[model samples]
Target: MYPFLRLAKEFYVHRNDPALPLTGTHVSHHLCWPWDLDLWMELNNGRTLTLLDLGRLPLARRVGLIAVMKSQGWGLTMAGVSVRYRRRVRMFDRFHTRSRCIGWDERFIYIEQGMWRGGECCNHALYRAAVTDANGIVTPDRVMRAMGLDVASPPLPGWVSAWIEAEAKRPWPPMAE
Candidate 1:
């Protein structure tokens, strides 16, 4: 199993503001395609370390990370994503991306991620993950249990929780809207 704490720490370290400049443009230019792993690979300069790479960072490792977090009695999920790109990453460019747990609530967890190349910000993304099940139903407690964590009523950080609540209220644009 993957170590959740270590992954979480690594993710957190890469979060930043997407509107910032990377190279010459704002990070928004890099997000033209969402599910393109090739673009991600290119961004990393023919190397591996893209979001898909991170997502596939050994399922066992991710499961272990989730297990550790659940053991702490915290709720989390992988819900939705919003990414903005600033510039096109070319071959041989070395970049870094960070993810951070901004907050959470009864239904979702809010994460902020940022990508940088050579000290310039390249991309920024906000992810909203649902605390749900395979059927896509909200069940934070059950999800926690599935990870082998004993449930607790521990208080969450104010900023983290508040961010989730605020994000939950935003109206998501429809696919054809």
Candidate 2:
């Protein structure tokens, strides 16, 4: 089940919060409920992605991106992601998440986030997200302007640039056929 109620409550709690800078991190705390577990008695891989939404949405809010989306009738979606799960998180365990926008390319924005327990990271992820309009994907520069930021984007991290380069070499449409 989706955490609709939890998201709604979080919306109110962080509603009045001021927007964050492009690189600022939004930290959120969570508990692994019984429903969040898998048959193995640990967090499910699918549910991990779903729960990430709980952190990311608040991040979008803190960055004032949601407001811009609402005003422009835009939508947001993840284009890609690379996540690593290093340890198991069992039910009733408490953890905190840290999410931030790392940088952007011509077509996508990159975000990095992590789940930590007692200062140890159990999982981390890098994501490519796109802002969409009726026409299709919106450029990052356009989005920056909408957010009232006139500054140029920061340089892409070495790892991010490498990933982009790697993606370009990957064969599209699949090789299964």
Candidate 3:
């Protein structure tokens, strides 16, 4: 299950939130439901990624990305992601997620997100996302313009830049053993 109801609840909860600048952080709270657990009785890795969406989508809404996409007939898609998990989230445990756009390049936007419990980070993820329309991928410049912003992207953090560089060198379709 994709938790559509929870997403709707989140939208309702933050409907009145102030609009955020391109890089402003949006934070959302969540609980670890029993169904979100794996065999070890902690949050499953895949579920963590799915749960992070609860934060990411709200961030997109707060920043007006969703509205722009809808109006421009553009779709938002994740091109790549890297995640780190450092702590356990047992059933019923409460946590908060923080999400923000780190920066963008000509073709892609980079987002940073983290899950925290009791003021400690439990996991973090970096996402490479794209905006697309009928032709193909839409440039970040056009996306920004649609959102009524004319500013340039802040420089991408070193780690995110490194990841982009490394991904460039990786063989597509991957190599067979």
Candidate 4:
């Protein structure tokens, strides 16, 4: 089951957090509940992806993206992601997530996030996200302008740029065996 209750709790808990600049980081804490585990008794990779929402949505809310989307009839969607897992998170383990928008290009926004425990990173992810309307994807420039920022996006980091290039070369719909 999706952790709707936990997501609601996250929203309620951070409801009054101060607004953030577009590139500012949002940090939220979490626990590795038993249900979040896999057969190996560590955090499930799939659940880790879902738990990330607990941080990303709040980050969007703090940066005014939620409001912008609401007023403009836009929806947010993930276009792609890359995650790296490095440590075990057993049941009852406590950790925190840090999320931020690294930058954007003509069509997509790039976000970076990480899960940490005991001062070490357990996992990290990079997400390519898009803002869409009924017509189609809304350009990042338009999204920025709607949020009242006319500034140019900071340069995307080299690694993120490389990832984008690599994705472009990947076959769409994948090849059949």
TM-score of each: 0.46, 0.95, 0.98, 0.98
Please give the TM-score that candidate 1 achieves against the real structure: 0.46
lDDT of 2 by residue, 15-115 (tens): 88777887799888889999999999999988898888888999998998999999999999998888999989999999988999998988999989899
RMSD of 3: 0.8
CA lDDT for candidate 3: 0.95
- Regions of model 4 farther than 4 Å from truth: none
Clashes of each: 17, 0, 0, 0
lDDT (0 to 1) per candidate: 0.47, 0.90, 0.95, 0.97
lDDT of 1 by residue, 3-29 (tens): 355446444543442321111121211
Evaluated at residue 83, the lDDT of candidate 3 is 97
lDDT of 4 at 40: 99
Instruction: Give the RMSD in angstroms, all C-alphas superposed, for model 2.
Output: 1.3
**Would you list the rank order by TM-score, best first?**
4, 3, 2, 1
Per-residue alpha-carbon lDDT of candidate 3 for residues 62-177, written as tens digits (9 for 90 to 100): 99999999998999899999999999999999999999998999999999999999989999999999999999999999999999999898988888999999999999989888
lDDT of 4 by residue, 1-177 (tens): 999999999999999999999999999999999999999999999999999999999999999999999999999999999999999999999999999999999999999999999899999999999999999999999999999999788999999999999999999989888
User: Largest TM-score belongs to which candidate?
Assistant: 4
